[model samples]
Target: MNWDSDELRAAALKLLLLATLRETKVAAPLLAELEELGMVAPGTRKGEFRLLAQQEDKFRRYLSVRWPEFAETEQAFSARPTLISAIALRALRRAPLKLPAGITQLNRKTWSAWAGAHSKSGCATPPPGILLTSDENLRLRPNAGLQIIGEQGGTLDADVCRALFGELIVPERGFSRNWHVTGVLPWLVLTVENIGAYIDITIPPWLLLVHAPGRNTLLATRFIDRLPATVPWVHFGDLDPAGLDIALSMRGPQTGRTPVPWIPHIAFELLETHSLPLSSPWPTQHLPQKLLEHPVLAWLIAHQRWLEHESIVVLSGLVEDVTKLAEMLRER
Candidate 1:
């Protein structure tokens, strides 16, 4: 198999975990860490470590240089895979994890896929529309067919919006009227608490639909730039780290116009009820450098807490909270 760097690294982690299982004096802390990371699969933790009785000198050398701390733990576990040594480590570590009955190849394939899915420890790719808001209209003129007005005061239809306009045009929603370069933006741009909430479209009238799953915040930002700076972009999402990070990403460099949190009290309430763990052993470090500097984001990261927008949907407070948000923004 032509393993890429990412695949090789994934394979190496599996080897490291399996090798650690072989140690006679398995440390309690290490096991706890593994559990916290959700790395151990059910039924697999019960098996005895029968892979390799004797540690290879080359493997030991690799471990010493790669993860010296883990190597010094007095346990015979394999080293954590570095970005470069993953390929070699996988080759060396696999032999020791072979199952009996000569099913090593089958076991290796299964373990590799499972580990690759679960072992990705970086910040997740933020989902579309999760935290961005724009003043894009979702109202469609079914009779309007494809003709959309262009910036040059000419009309371009569905073909142009779909092909050339790209992120400049709203997804799924067609132009009800001709598009123009200059127009007055509404005072509030509201991103739906749930991207799939079709019921949210015209409730408040001023709430603009931001269909981010079909696109993303970066694209939405392009459209939002045309709006007046006084317009406050509001976001409602889960109260988790990812949700806050999404909001941070959507806000971008418009430091003056922070996206208003819609009914954050509801998220906090749900968080209190669920009592969910705020951070993980592998917390996301994916916020952009600019966003990382924001005080709110910095505090969230420091405290390791977030609230999800989904919690509001479950409590049936979406409409009421959104109504409150519109009223609040008007007051601001």
Candidate 2:
């Protein structure tokens, strides 16, 4: 869904502004989410669509008029403040469209000026914060620090590292003849495509480790410094242009080593073998200059084939491939 369509962008922006007015509490939206809602689709030919840049401008003006104090005046539409506002607004509007047991809830105004606003009565009671979704309230608050979410922290399991890291690790404490201490520690960083996957999936731990960090640990930025210098931080995400771009952005310009793809081989194979089911023709365009040099990205662009992380997860050979890749990286 090219959410950056004029209607969607304007609706998103208005929704964002409405969230701020109501003071929705949540972590800001991630850049990928913002891009999904704003940027042109990948492989789009030059001058395909003029873009909703004009609509965005109008929305910004409306925001400035409606809430000048919180309006964004910047080139990056997904500025922190704007995203945070959007998160808050989404948190407030999460009520299901209809009640359970065949009750109907009508939204007469589909494209309303605001969310959770009523001229006559205002919003109903706000729901508890715990019920908010990641789009509304993400759990990636680094300040909260890192803690194991699944299993218990004693030793780090090899499978856990394989799943979370590309099997990047070095022992934090040296081994002993009588007993190895702390087992193997994770050296790589993982950035999941969806927060739900990050939270819901239970990474079963192999009992071989002397001390395994729980399978479901909430990874945070504050823990990066603890990793070994040799361990390259990698991102696991969709095999699409946007996902690749997100990984590059996370690595920034400073990392000495490229963040290896968690499943580039699979992605390459998918591109070579499968066809995307789209309702309409996608615009044909040359790959972006920055991405052209990358072999995996180049292939995807050349074929105009894109794969979502969810799809990859369900592939028959995913687990085996993931484990094999982990071993390969570990040896490297």
C-alpha lDDT of all candidate models, in order: 0.44, 0.39
**Tens digit per residue, CA lDDT, model 2, 21-77:** 211222123223434656322224431222244345554554455443334323234
**Evaluated with lDDT, which candidate comes out highest?**
1
Instruction: For candidate 1, list the clashing residue pairs, or say none.
Output: 129-212, 237-309, 238-307, 238-308, 238-309, 239-306, 239-307, 239-308, 240-306, 240-307
Q: Scored by Cα lDDT, where does model 1 land?
A: 0.44
Name the Cα RMSD for model 1: 16.4
Tens digits of lDDT, candidate 1, 1-332: 22233343333344454553422233333334444544432234554222232433444454455453334332432344333243344444444553345331222234444333333322233223222222344422111123445655775454334344321245422222335323334446655445544233333334454543322554455445545666667765655555555665565434434565444444444544653456463155664565456554444456665544544555555556666766776787
TM-score of each: 0.38, 0.35
Candidate 1: list runs displaced more than 4 Å.
Answer: 1-149, 152-185, 192-194, 197-202, 213-215, 251-258, 272-275, 280-306, 314-316
| Number of the top TM-score candidate | 1
